[model samples]
Each structure stands twice: as structure tokens, then as C-alpha cells.
Target: MKELKSEVSGFVVSLEAKAGDEIAAGQVVLLVESMKMEVPVEAQMAGTLEEILVGEGDSVAEGDVVAHVREA
Candidate 1:
């Protein structure tokens, strides 16, 4: 399993996938509000969403794990 992390510090806007949800590579798994703009965070590989390490409206910093994905 590979964990996806936030590229920068920001407030989470939305979670595009939930645990057990299968997703494709490059899909927007989460959105972050930074610099007053929405930044979509994409999956780096196709996999089942294993866990979400954060929730909407949560604040996270760069290099923080946002979600985990189990590769199909």
C-alpha cells in the first residue's frame, strides 16, 4: 500500500474517495484549499482507497499523509 500525501499545507475541501473505494490513477482523491484556491490532489497509481487520514475542513501540512491506497 502506498500512501498519498498533501503537497502543501492547506485546509481540506473535499474527499473524493472513501475507504474501500476503487480509484484510477490520476483521479482526484481529495481537494485542498490553499492560497484561496482549490487544489485537487490526484492519485499516483490505480488502487482501492484503503483509508483516509484526514477529513474535510481539516488542516494538514506538506508531506502529511492524506490517504492510503492499496494497489490493485
Candidate 2:
């Protein structure tokens, strides 16, 4: 399994992919609000989205593991 980590400290704005969904490299897995801007958290490798560790409106810091992926 690969971990999907947040790139910035922010509040989770939305989830673009759900658990069990197939994901591609660089695809937006979620959106995060930081410094008033929306930043996309992307998958680093193609895989099945295994789990989401954070919900919308949840706070996260940079490098925090937000999700797990079972590599394709």
C-alpha cells in the first residue's frame, strides 16, 4: 500500500475520490483550503483508493497521511 499525504497545512475542502475507486497518478484525490486558496491533493501512483483518513472540514498538516492506496 502507498500513502497519500497532504502537501500543505489546511482544511480538507472536498474529496474527489472515494474508497475502492481506481485512481491514477497525479489525479486529484481531494481539495484542501490553505491561505484562502484551494489546493489539490493528488495521488502519486496509480492504484485503488483503499481508505480516506480525513473528512471534509478536517484539519491536516503538511506530510500528514490522508489516505492509503493499494498499488495497481
TM-score of every model versus the real structure: 0.96, 0.96
Q: What is the lDDT of residue 26 in candidate 1?
A: 98
Q: Output the number of the lDDT-best candidate.
A: 2
Candidate 1: segments with Cα more than 4 A from true spot: none
Give the per-residue lDDT of model 2 (tens digit) for 20-53: 9999999999999999999999999999999999
The sequence of per-residue lDDT tens digits that candidate 1 reaches over residues 1-72 is 998989989999998889899999999999999999888888999999999999999999988999999998
Which residue window of length 10 is worst by lDDT in model 2? 1-10
Whole-model Cα lDDT per candidate?
0.92, 0.96
Clashes of 1: 0
After superposing candidate 2 on the true structure, give the runs of residues whose Cα lies further than 4 Å from its correct spot.
none
